[model samples]
Target chain A: MSRVGVVAIRRGIRVSIYLPIAELSVNMIILLAMGGAVGFLSGMFGVGGGFLITPLLIFYNIPPAVAVATGANQVIASSFSGALAHFKRGTVDIKLGMVLLAGGVAGSSVGVYVFALLRALGQLDLIVSLLYVVFLGTIGALMMWESIGALRKAGKGGSTTLKKPGQHNWVHRLPLKVRFRASKLFVSVIPVLGLGAFIGFLASIMGVGGGFIMVPAMIYLLKVPTNVVIGTSLFQIVFVAAFTTIVHASTNQTVDVVLAFLLMLGGVAGAQYGAKVGQRLRGEQLRALLAGLVLIVAIRLAVDLFVRPADVYSLAPGVL
Target chain B: MKRCARKHALAVIGMLLAVAVGGPSAFAQDQGEPPRETINIGLSTEVVAITPDFSGADLTIFGSLENPDPQILRQGRYDIIVVLEGPLRPVVVRRKDRIFGLWINVDSETFSSVPVSYSVAMTRAPQDITDAKSYKQLSLGIDNIHLRPAGENADPSKTEEFGLALRSLKQRSGLYNERVGSLTFIGSNLFRASLALPANVPVGTHRARAFLFRNGSFIDEASDQLMIVKSGTEASIYRAANTYGFFYGVFAVILAVITGWIGRIVFKRD
Candidate 1:
């Protein structure tokens, strides 16, 4: 059961939970509900909940700056748990994850600087929202289309062959080749590093763990085994999120620990329950559901961009 | 929790009672002195401590309209406007313009000094109480608040519209409020108003100003101060997060890791 009894009401229609960095009180129930919903989806789909949580936080009237930074803080917890589970299963490629982590940390630093510049220019909200619409829209559509194709293939009783990774791909032709025994792939470290850096850049600016993006990129592009992709992505995400948290905390002062803690209270439990529920669903069905959810969020964001806002002007503290 | 909240309420009431009983006699003691314009005010609490359990507070402002001429009192032409204004801070107001079929922030205005929260209670509607010139001079209403832009680039004439937009936004957020005839009279000379400080009220020293008007003319104004501060664990955490950000971030990471580990143990699956 949810800890509904813990909620303390301030006034009519308000159950306030003070966010330290945001320096405001938000509805406790709403924050927890959002966290739980995203956490459940993360556990069921093996995607970091940040992609959903950050957008939902924005919808709840949290400042985009605060939402992105604090979302990174919260992702640390979820990714840590997910990573540990994969570690215990012996699916995590620790060396590859470390290399990705190194690249991710460097990339996040540059991303944080870029985020600061956009914020200074008062374009952070526009950029973040636009990024969400483009990336989420493209990724969701692709996932849905691919999963539908797989489902159709299964329906026709045809055997599907995954083209052997690293065989004739441009990724293998690059210099500085390294062998990863766990995924049984021999690939250039340059592409892996470049991929990690790109995902890290997106993760920092978009307030997502970049797991959904990273998982697909690793499997199809880097040719990492399906079993190892989730674990390695989680491993890299943990460090990237932690690094992003510190950078944001030190620079932007937007990491609201109080809010993050409250979110985790619901997220941790919801993830466990969701994992249990996930055991009953097939892989294609899970992918379909996740893709549908992503598309829905993307469309919602797109509609917001097109629709006229009731108030054309907004106020944030401090001079531009 | 119920008992704790009641205790706080009782404490506030006791303070108000002390002020009510002790205030008049002190001022009346100087009987031979010439009468002068004076306003005496007392708050239910001078300081609001926002601990982790603090949701918000309903603050009471009680005061007396002292030394008004007996003739004016008899004429019953006095109006009172009580305003509580939060600390001034810079604010950015952005306007979205349609660009290529999508709304984007094309124009922006920055106000160097604007109250984070402002609430006003008047004895009657502002328009009925005074003329527009006096209202602007006194900043009596939400629309009349003078929030000037930081830089001179913004056109002066467009500021009114921008100010109105800011007011609407703040009003929707429950940070700005205006109430007509909300103040009640305890007697002919004493009046009190209660303001509900929303949970999101900006933490700072707030000014509670009361203005007196008679026959559509400004009479006298008195102002008092109230401080809202974070206390207990909330304060400590907030302090750490701001003062020692990098360490706090690391601590946050450790906390998350520990919680995640414990969650894994508790929810262990074969």
Candidate 2:
């Protein structure tokens, strides 16, 4: 019997595995390696790796829907493990995290609804790519700018201390103030909830844990202590990502457990080593490197949008 | 229609049997009014179970032509076409147009009840066996398969464009395919056809249809059902995902949590 179809048989041994929900066979080692690479980056940056994983999966030709949903699923594992470490260190602000979780849940619900709407409208891929380009470009550019300034200061033998948190911003003047004992600050619930909701929305749509956005927002916007920021952001991300995964699975039925599992296994293992390596690097240098990586991804996605596709037409499973 | 075809096939088989037992004189006497030719196909297995590592396989369909004309068979005037058509489902075809330096989906058309996959094997080139008119009438070839736009009043030109796009996309993906000269005569009466089942073949009930053409004219046609399904664990996973999505979602989350916990324990350094 002659074998035929998309997967061409190579001369050497190849370990291919089938993803049930994705409905395709992919090289197992390639998936694991992708997970490990993203996991390493996330560990070094003290962020969830969902932002990297979703786009990588898309590049590998996994359907955007499956890639997004499964990315959310994979984020839960890394964030949960990271959160556990933070919990042990007693750095996570549980009260602040809970409030953020509340807003995240609500925002995720709306995001999932919109995701389905966009998918049905046959604009999901475009919207997803567009969003990635916008967010990644903005964040990467900002990080690069900030870190370069810090690097220049250090080069001149000046202390690269972070800005004093007590300096009040307009966000501090907002109403509905809430006190979080762990972070030792008084902050408005309005911005906290809104920020959580915004990240949650992006998490559901982009299949990210939102840590890349959440950590910075906590430190710069909410004025949360830097010591507690990573832990608290991760705490909320764990639950938010969990919530997004369940909803996407139940509503869209797009989550592939097999794919998620492979990613998670490789991720958690790689993260530990990444964290060790991260500790040896200076904060400014790490930020600069991460910014460069993010910008490259953004530029690649932008190129795809601008370049003519191989085919002008595409097919979807359902009627529009 | 299937029952009628089956009856015709039985009659052809009965006549062939009578001629076999009644000797040369019996066949000579029956030649004055030649019996109608009929086609029948049998699959080696009723269902094809795809394992996890399944790449692709050739599905051999054994068939026979009853009451075939001796002269037509000898002269290679008889031709057979076998098609394995996947289950029907609605499909949307979208066209991307350049908008502000970005290619975005600007137009789309929906086609209902479109076959998910169509694989055809023939005794000869489709054009060599029959005229285009006959092929279109019978809907025997890929181009001949009718695609109906979901909207009743869709633009004819747009609908045709989308329909062509859909066919080419399916062909590019190996879901819709054709293999010329894949059917061969085993002897004088029996023929075998090999249809390539692509690795990405959709799991559902597929129809195996055989069309007979003698001297470039349409003759009898017959079809049988074949089930293509994922086997064991893969089958259960697919079913569970579609059927009990809520529980599956919960399970997925729990599995992730456990994996995370275990990873920390095994590789714990802190």
Interface RMSD of candidate number 1:
2.4
Candidate 1 lDDT over A1-320, as tens digits, reads: 01132333335566776677776567788788888888888888877799999899888778889899888888988899999999989999988998888889888999999998898777898899999999899999988987787777878986544435554677778999988888887888998888888888988899888998898889888878888999999999999999999998888777888888877767887898888788898776777788899999999988988999877787766644
lDDT of 1 by residue, B183-225 (tens): 7667657889777675567789999999888777887889999
Interface RMSD of 2: 1.2
Candidates' chain B TM-scores in the order shown: 0.80, 0.89
lDDT of each: 0.80, 0.88
Off by over 4 Å in 1: A1-16, A22-30, A160-163, A179-185, B1-34, B50-58, B232-236
In terms of docking quality, model 1 is acceptable
C-alpha TM-score for every candidate: 0.86, 0.94
Q: Single out the weakest 10-residue window by summed lDDT for candidate 2 chain A.
A: A1-10
Global fold similarity of model 1 (TM-score): 0.86
